[model samples]
Target chain A: MANTHISYTALPGRSRPYFGVLYLVELVFTFGLLAIGERTRLYLGPDHLLVLRRRFFTETAHRFYFSDIQAITVQRTTNAVTANAVLFLLCALTLGVLGLYPFSGGMILLGDFSFGEELLLILACAGFGLGLALNILLGPACVTELITAVSREPLPCLSRWGTAQRALALLVPRIETAQGVPSPEFLNVQPVLAAYATPAGRLITQPPITHDSGRLHELLFGLYLLMSVSCMIDLTGNWMIKNAFDSLLFMIVLVLSCIALLRQRHSDIPSDIRSLTGFALGFSVLLFYFTRPFTMLHMFWNMPENFDPAILMSSMLNPDDPLYVAYVGTQLAVDLFVGLLGLLGIYRFRRLYRLAQHNAALDTPPPPASNVEEPPAAP
Target chain B: MSTALTAWSGTACPRCGREMERLPSNSVEPRVCPHCKTSFIALLFPAAVQNEFLGRYGEPLREESEAACFYHADKRAETACDRCGRFLCALCAIDTQDKRYCPQCLENGIRSGELPEFQSAYPRHDLLALAVACIPLMLAIPILLIVLPWATDIALGFALGLLLFPAFVTAPASLYLALRFRKTVTHPLGRRAGWFPLTVLLAAGQMVVWAVAIIVFTGSLFSEF
Candidate 1:
């Protein structure tokens, strides 16, 4: 009923750029991968909201009409974000000061910091300082979601507190003009209205669908197993045929993990499992991207005069090579920790899912027992 | 058309769909989700409480002269479908009290995009053109520098002799894409402004860089000769 084709640019909302915490790292490492971060923009129209998301050379636009919108949910999420900022800032300051051991005139740190340690400390300081800057720039994190008749989605690039609030100030007025506020009496009578609308036989309630992510859990666990094992093998890795195989395996595992993550998005996976899986996936991708350039440049920098594949392999993976040992050792440690915990989570999830199934089956008539592989019973 | 499908009694967790502790309408304070511990402020509107009107049942025909419904032979015909002339009972009608159509006609209308109000998604090729104009050159430089080992040595001469292959290839394609989508409308709310020229300019910039590099290399070669 209202004019829908005018930009509401007069709304003085200062939206902060949000580079997703996990993705910010990926962007720095991979560089030019998918134009991530502040590329997601929200344009306010007179009667609709346009969320324009830019990814690489393509753009996706999601539009929501004001008249059709039913609710706006805003969640405060600053605690974790603030905590992370402080942690990064403190770590940066500490590591940076430690790196200044030579310049400190033997005053700050009692023990000697080796050249390698100094280099690592400085890099760590830079990394943490970058993290601190990004966190501050991201502003106080908040999740604001828009719910219409058909879909409920978070507003892209409106994660900051000040921005979302100002945007809402602009939005609520337009929405109010479109949809008038109901009487208090009318608001209280919703339950009675729903009761009256339903026909007699058609109103019978159906059992809620069970949240079964058993197969997905098992699949992810299997991939993690492969990833951990590959990492272990790479601990002593040469640039052999097997190293290529391991690379292929890691690629496969990453792809499958992404698939699993997508599938488990709307499912009722526990929060702990979801958080841990997300972290592990993000860390692995970050590590992969960060290490790849150095490895390439290292190989080219030390290119043999009489180039031979065998000689290159030996040089790249020489027992005395600190680079190989350090990278592989770090990878192994992370893989072992996350992979084992994830496996435990999978086992626990499967056991719980089975228990739920078993309980749900109790209400129905017992079926004849079949020779299926029984999983280890939950304690 | 009806608000019943959109309505829910209490707020559900956005992360996990468990029903959270209910708060008063437009409460300033946040309610933390019991399961996930995510704090939320739900601004419930009047639509949440609005009653839905269900479809009316078709009346049974009592007289012989009464027009029979196409779907239900025993019921009296309520109205004719707008798209097709088939008689429809009250139950068989699609859409709100607005446009009247049979189920088949409504389905066809949605799929054919004849009803623009029902369609929300349409791609913007003009935006794609601009993105194509700039992204490739940025991606090419860092990767080529490292992989080819040509940042600062004698290899720098060789690197200069050969302009970035990605930029050379993409420049023409970007220009073509820009020109093709030059007249396409991008933003619905904004005034008609052309960004294709900007895209063309970016492509031209890449071309100029490639030209400069080529000229320098050729000049160096000719001077050496």
Candidate 2:
């Protein structure tokens, strides 16, 4: 049980390597493969295994690297696995549809990433991410699903009349059953009237008020999934889209990612919160790149009509130009939001870790019972 | 009113005072008087409130769910009988979710030594329950077939295969195991857990793995296929 306790002080130093490795490997491997393929004009097999292997390796590497994550909550693990499987299953089908592209299959139009190779790579990455998510979420998902399912099922025999009535009903079980009416000897009028204020009875009278905070973490999780998927889509499709559209798409993805991170920072997060964090950092680069094009456009839009088109096109943009300044400012703002959200997310996760530790301390058992009662007879 | 005992200035009676501890009482209901061994009325907390108070005050109170013995009316059982609702104290709880018992009765029928006691409630969903749960998965198959095509077929194929696999593998294995041990060998969850999920995982995992593998081994595995 103590192993489940998450200490805030120990969390910050642990996840960095996994994040760094995924980032570096994706950057080098994705761009390197693309460069080689583009320069050589080579088509890997219609089914690319090497690219998929790299992705699997990079993700699996993190399992050992972050094995310190001790107890995975049941609900979270299940949700993660189920959601991941569903998404990957969707992605695989989508790519398989894309495989029909050369055959002029009408289904290929769903995604903008048209190059067979690029489409395949993007799908591979999405699938691997989904798999890792599924593995982590499976154990917890089963528990949550079981608990949630059981909680909703009604117990036919545990009647509202309370245990005392049930006990008496047990004494003359045949007569009561034969009569097809509730036993009168078991009724207690006074306690039933007084039960409105009793703890055991109050549950029947009062509706529980669920604070929205319980759901905020999950909502944030959903948003994270959307942003991550969108970013993957945009990154894969980047070569096919106009620069302006790419920048806009990237910014939207980044902004959405930060918003999710900010919400996660303020909630009682599950372990997958680390995954969300890693995803946010990966998209941050795309966000910054998106802003780069916007900064250039801002300068282009601000230029005087008389200004030479050559000078404007020659350089990225004049740094002192108002348009350039505006573009840079907007980019800076996005960067700052991402950074701030990351910091706050880490801080909240740490607090949660500490709280988990504190709770574990409270569950300590008392020493063994003295003069214990004999075990009761089996019914 | 037992005034003679009160008049003794709270002194312990030499005969039974040590054996009979003075427990708190309620005037509305009856209680045994420590000194007189007689039922008497006194102002005291109600049973429900008394239990709560004892719980707060760190006193051990009776468990609300204590099982009672099937044959013995006076005896309270520690565990529930798997066959009947009777409480089998420590001695009778059974762990079979097989044909012999439903969950409530199964809790009663098993021997205490056979089943592991869980301190924290381990919520169980039996084969029937698991089957009922697959209702959603059952519903999901068509939707997935429509929505997610490529690898879902593989999963759908496996789900179909499970029906045959159990008949082919489980039936034969059960017979083989019975001959050796002279008892049945069955693992319900294990037999099905891997196939459905592993199909989904492998379908998805393969898509990612194979695609990347082919791309990385671009020169080696690159074909128009």
Candidate 3:
């Protein structure tokens, strides 16, 4: 047997989004890679493959020994498609801005920045361009899974097809050496044993035990619609428009979105609805903070002689500036669009979920009814 | 519970439970599952063919001399539970790693976290140390960015003061974390051990820088008074 203990190689790839909204925070604060998020790295160890998953302060290590690993599976995901579209859009926008720079004179319309600051901004764009290049060059994204008899673990770093194949190249040899190659007689086995093994009493599909998630999806989307409309109306500043309720509506949507997201995490609701729930939450956050720096700058420029604490808060809340209106107005428009999409997603999800539940109900044998009814109640 | 513990045999497309085509020993090309059309690469080992368990139905008591299982009065005892010393039949005996425990003892072990392998996750001292060592500097970047371009001398002095004040707290805290968490289960690839030491070194360097800056700052303040 080969000594499976001495040499360890760090597998390629880092588990994180092609782009996380959190990356914006990193870009703003650190000006580093616009793609840094939770990093879950894989290591080929002597005895076992170790998965080091780092999130916040906690690190979880999951070890899978080569002898016990029954199989390795890699499946394609739509993450690459989504990432490519977003990056392409970003690249186009940045290129357009850069194109306009010469025609617009030296004055930047967004804000007055010093030479050093402009240099930093240009460097940040280069970073985003590099990210777009990397995303495209990597080709399609995939999720690689290592299956043992008792556990199936996702290897996050091998998130791309090319990297996953390379990972398999390293892993296959080690695993094969650990457990000798199967005999020719069983070489073409068509997972007949897997069908038999279905972990004993469990069926191929799980028994549906879904309860209506109290229409959390509907309520969430309804709130999204309400907030989107209210914010838009507030911007109009028309006659008798209740602008103060805008913040209240925002808070309601924020809370409801979080609750709805968590509640529907493992539900039978269609994936599209769940994705929209997440998007609604994210877009809501974007709406809240995307205009923050611009507003803050406006406040700094318009600072009164006597800077009262109350004035600062009130001023920020109602910037009363044309730029704030433009920025915030665009944000509200997008929020309204997402909210409308969310409502559409929820309708589709309800239809799908109900049909699934109906089918499941039809498939399941009536245990209680069969046991209690004798076809003749002693009437 | 049985459904939850369904062994995730690499037999099916995970998304849809359609049986995936198993690769022959030599075939390494990935294939998409026909049902889900999800591209998948699956390799089934020798163990996948063999039944993991035949049946754990404990043998009925045949001879009066055999000690009966504690859980099953009629079943013969196969082994003594390693934790509680209870006689357990094959059905009740839960074998985990080197230890064999009865169902009750195993549940207790898991709940109380007496077993190290079962613990889900814990804070990495090395990473905590790293955060402490690096976060102040990370924060300094944004402050310097915002304040620096307005005026060079004012920005320099202001940023230094801000960095120095935080460094006094963060640098020492980082050192403490590094020393305290010296024995954290480091990285498997031998890359696990460096973060703590790096944090300690960075903390020490930060302390030195902060001390000089604070001294100059205080000296200037006092000189002005």
Candidate 1 chain A TM-score vs. reference chain A: 0.58
| CA-lDDT, candidates in order | 0.61, 0.33, 0.66
| Model number with the top lDDT | 3
Chain B alone vs. reference chain B, TM-score for every model: 0.57, 0.17, 0.62
Span of ten consecutive residues with least summed lDDT in model 2 chain B: B1-10
The parts of candidate 3 lying over 4 Å away from their true place are A1-7, A18-38, A104-124, A182-187, A192-379, B1-26, B32-38, B54-123, B151-158, B183-192, B213-225
All candidates: TM-score: 0.55, 0.19, 0.61
Candidates ranked by lDDT, best first? 3, 1, 2
Model 3: lDDT equals 0.66
- Candidate 3: CAPRI quality band: acceptable
Candidate 1 local lDDT, B150-187, one digit each (tens): 34555554444344666777788889988776665444
Using TM-score as the measure, what is the rank order of every candidate, best first?
A: 3, 1, 2
Question: Taking the tens digit of each residue's C-alpha lDDT, what string does model 3 give over B1-225?
Answer: 123323344556655556654554544677766643567777767666665666578888999889999999999999999988999888998887788999888778766758645654555677677777776667777788777656578787877677677788989998998988797544334444567768889999999997887799999999999
TM accuracy, model 3 = 0.61
The regions of model 1 sitting more than 4 angstroms off are: A1-5, A9-67, A74-132, A139-144, A159-166, A173-277, A288-293, A296-300, A303-379, B1-8, B11-21, B54-125, B128-149, B152-186, B200-225
Poorest lDDT segment (10 consecutive residues) of candidate 2 chain A: A144-153
Tell me the tens digit of each residue's lDDT in model 3 across A168-240: 8877888888888876556555443333233234345343224444477777777766766766665655322
The DockQ for candidate 3, computed on C-alphas, is: 0.23
- TM-score-superior candidate, 1 or 2: 1
Clashes of 1: 0
